[model samples]
Target chain A: MVSLQAAVESAAPVSRLHERASFDPADFPVPGGREEEWRFTPLRRLRRLHADGPLDAGKAGVEADAGPEITVVAAEHGDPRLGTAFVPADRVSARAFASFREATIVTIPGGVAAERPVVIRVRGEDAGQAAAGHVLVEAGANSSAVVVLEHAGSATYADNVEFLVGDGARLDVVSVQDWARDAVHLSHHHAVLGKDATFTHMAVTLGGDLVRLAPSVRYAGPGGNAELRGIYFADSGQHLEHRLFVDHARPDCRSRVTYKGALRGDGAHTVWIGDVVIRPEATGTDTYEANRNLVLTDGARADSVPNLEILTGEVVRAGHASASGRLEDEHLFYLTARGIPVEEARRLIIRGFFAELIGQIAADQVRAKVTAAIEAELDAMARAEGGAR
Target chain B: MSTLEIRGLHVSVAAQAGESREILRGVDLTVTAGQTHAIMGPNGSGKSTLAYSIAGHPKYRVTSGSVTLDGRDVLAMSVDERARAGLFLAMQYPVEVPGVTVSNFLRTAVTAVRGEAPKLREFVREMNGAMAALSIDPSFAQRNLNEGFSGGEKKRHEILQLQMLNPKIAILDETDSGLDIDALKVVSAGINAYRQSPDHGVLLITHYTRILRYVRPDFVHVFVGGRIVAEGGPELADELEASGYERFLAMEGAPA
Candidate 1:
């Protein structure tokens, strides 16, 4: 039983060994497979990583890239208090108690529109170790921007990211998580929207051994809104899960969550759990959540659950729906009857499934990049099953 | 050389399984190029079923029949293969494919049926020309295929596909069902435009005589109880339209 305070304090690394001491795997606490949240996850996947050793930070590479119409604010160790305020100390302490400590802080100034995307690139060098980072975004009143966070590795790694959005500002955040096949990824993103603010987040997950993404958003002010969209594909012994929580804590707030995933090959499992809550005082709140899963193979499995907990009696609208099924035979028949080959028809349907989320992406470059990545993933899966035509 | 030949065709729905309540009971018909053939039938007379079976719908089981396009056996091929063999069915109810633009769908369908990739600029130019001819707005190209479209719009979309695909044999399954007079004229004009090549054959299925008045059929067949009972010149459509299907029903009962 580790305390949250101890975890935060432990994240404060000694100056001399900043590079080596920053991401040491030995300092984190193990889950021991008993926690309820970790029940469905395979802890052995984490055990295979190096449990007690410093990360090879010297091997880390920095490749800075610019994105479309996004403003990037890079502040390393800008202010520890900023991180403390954005990320609750208790959650920081938990990661710290688990011996994972590394941070990246980003800020967008008020009323500033960056025409190019701000890309935050994080890389890990070790195959069997853990790493964590933090991002804090502040958009001033009447400002808009987009942030592209890319997580990649030349080797296997486990990582986490925390994000925050500020008041009266709109933020479009795109996350591309493509790790090595042997890697395990655990990402935690927490966002808080302020008065009259709007936030749109889209995540594309294409590669990983066992990937779990928990994105939680809270509407803390009136007229605040959040739109969350994600696309995940798993194939050949891959396990991908996305758990989302959207809380409407104030009146006149709205939120929407949509996630779609495709699975192929045996032993592949895709899971989605969307939980939305409208508190008692959060009157005039509107929330809608939907999750759709496509199982491409007979042995593949998809489990989707959309849960809504509404406490307010004056809410305008609140509902959640989930669907898990194979491709529709009628759609396939219609396409094939038009002279499209069966394999091409399947590809088109899969592409169309993800196109819904991709179409909602406001930025053209981001949408194109995500679509290309998804197609590549599908091609790889098709090749693995020897079903590519 | 374009001709659709059906011999001893027996088709049934999948739900009935081996019980086999035949929709096209041993029906034989020949439709050659350079001719318009109208199939007039009453409701539940299996007009659309015959059209679907010829186009290779998965639900329409061909118990013991053979459909040939030109010299190629159509029944032995897949739906897509039959389409590529130059057979087209203008579905009475076109399926809506959300998120797929009509232009993209038509382009893919045309290229697939032709077995070659078409030049993009040329395809667009030709598509625009067809749209204008069909009285369809240019914006319709950007919309999802047949989604949220009015009944007339759906029928126009089917005609647009017909003009673009340009199959050797086109089967129009009640293509004039839901159109107003203006839309019907526009659609008939588009179909007439497709008649430039005598190598193209048309199997027009309709319960009314209005479309036949516009696109004057060269031959007419009266279908009753899942079988064609009588065949005559274009005068037969006028006869059927004037006297209804009672004469055809009596002819069918004559047992010849």
Candidate 2:
């Protein structure tokens, strides 16, 4: 019989387990949809960004805004600071790394706290051509900053984002993928935290035809803390997937992952996978991960999986939970019985389901924008589903 | 003054294998303005069913009966419509709506009932007054509605809504089931304070007469086997408390 340790080890893909990180596109092979990581993704809709497809020469529309305490520069791909945080793990990221002409590097000086966030907006111009881009946000020692990356418009895009947080630093990153319905995007977010550093990353995926985001974290030293939070809404014919990996290679580190999603309409689907591993030598690690999905209408599907693997017995805590379900009947009754109309009650519950997570967002504008987008989505869902009532 | 009249109310709940079982079998009662009606019964005596059926819970279907609030066909109204028409039920077990704060829910409820959103200052003052009367911490208003609340906290929150909504008719379904003596006294005082107005009516359903000792009922009903077997004044409550529900269950042949 295979041992429990072997079984647990086999649950996650070996490719991701000993992740091959390189900036060379030749180091990765094109997936055939049979690989565990690509099994759930629809490859045909990716517009050949996965293989030898030519990447557009022109950069996607890009804009950056930051306070005086930070610097934003578009340097060539050979910039020494470009890939300091992480190497390209998959084919798309490697392709983006190699094909992109220039990469945006945002740097905050050590010990200087930024009053405002470093905001970067990437707007895709065409759905007919595939595009590639890259961004790196670097926080020096004892520095505190917030960085937001907003993606919009319609195009087939692949990119990578690196966050390097220094010792005793604080970094909050909010990446929003609110594209047109015809857009197809794949992204990789890599973060490295130093001693006593704190990092938080929020991914709000609202409008995309097929969006897959992979975010992974690695600690450079002990006393590092990372929180990865995400929210997504999938309408008809849309696919949204978020996969996270938290690698605890150091002692006395902590990680928490929480993601919530809602699906409505036929063929609307969402997938959330949280993988956490505590190395044998990494004792005193505290971690918890959870994913909750709300299926609002017929013909919608959600798949949630949480994989927690521990090689050492000495741990502060380690746990995971995942659930996908419809709204409770009694929840509706409770709301309506309080004089909220049926439609309004359903909306309120859906909003309430997301409020707690959204409230934790540090940036006020992103939070308000996400809330308004959710309200609009709810309005459209009501208009479509209200006929039955 | 409003009147809630239930004439020959029969309610059946959906059960296993597509079959519906009758819970309230021809329950007839009238709760008028300025009166407190106590519905005392055993665990399976269906008194709670009577309360929910009148409140338009979709789970309990009304069959061959009529429930009217001030001559309006309450059975025909939706759950929210009934609430908008000044009907409220303090459930034995309130639902826990995560992320929906007590303050937000109360404001939404008050807005829906009053046909307009109250000004921020006015609403905060009103909520503060009601919460203070219930002895709830000011921070309690910011907590999610009934989420992680204790039994006493949930009951007190129900009464807080009762005060804020200021409904014409209130149905207390086993509100005193899970309360300590001190909480019971506080809840009773809240009910008594709300009942000081002659225009409000109350239908208190419970299994014991412990709460009736504090909030005396104008009418006492002994509910058993889906129907009221006896009705009288406060003396009936004392009699039942002294003798327990044994005699009534024996009379109904409810497998005692």
State which candidate has the highest TM-score.
Answer: 2
- TM-score of A-chain in each prediction? 0.82, 0.95
| Candidate 1: segments with Cα more than 4 A from true spot | A1-40, A48-93, A96-98, A154-160, A381-389, B16-21, B246-256
Which has the greatest lDDT?
2
Model 2, runs deviating above 4 Å: A1-18, A387-389, B253-256
Q: Look at candidate 1 and tell me the lDDT of residue A205.
A: 83
The superposed Cα distance between candidate 2 and the true structure at residue A79, in angstroms, equals 2.3
TM-score quality measure for candidate 1: 0.87
- The DockQ values of the predictions, listed in order, are 0.46, 0.80
lDDT of 2 by residue, A1-389 (tens): 11236533443433354367777889889999998778888899888889888886534888899998799999896888888778887899889888887788899999989999889999988878888888988999999998999999987889889999999999999999999999989999999999999999999999989999999999999999999999999999999999899988899999999999999999998989888888776789999999999999889999887887776667898888899999989999998898989888888889999998899787899999999999999989998976756
Over B1-256, each residue of candidate 2 has an lDDT whose tens digit, in order, gives 8999989888899999999998887778999989999999999989889988878888998888899999999998999999999899999999999888899889998999999999999999989988988999999989999999999999999999999999999999999998999999999999999888999999999998999989989999999999988899999999988999988886574432
- Native contacts, share recovered per candidate: 0.50, 0.77
Model 2 DockQ reads: 0.80
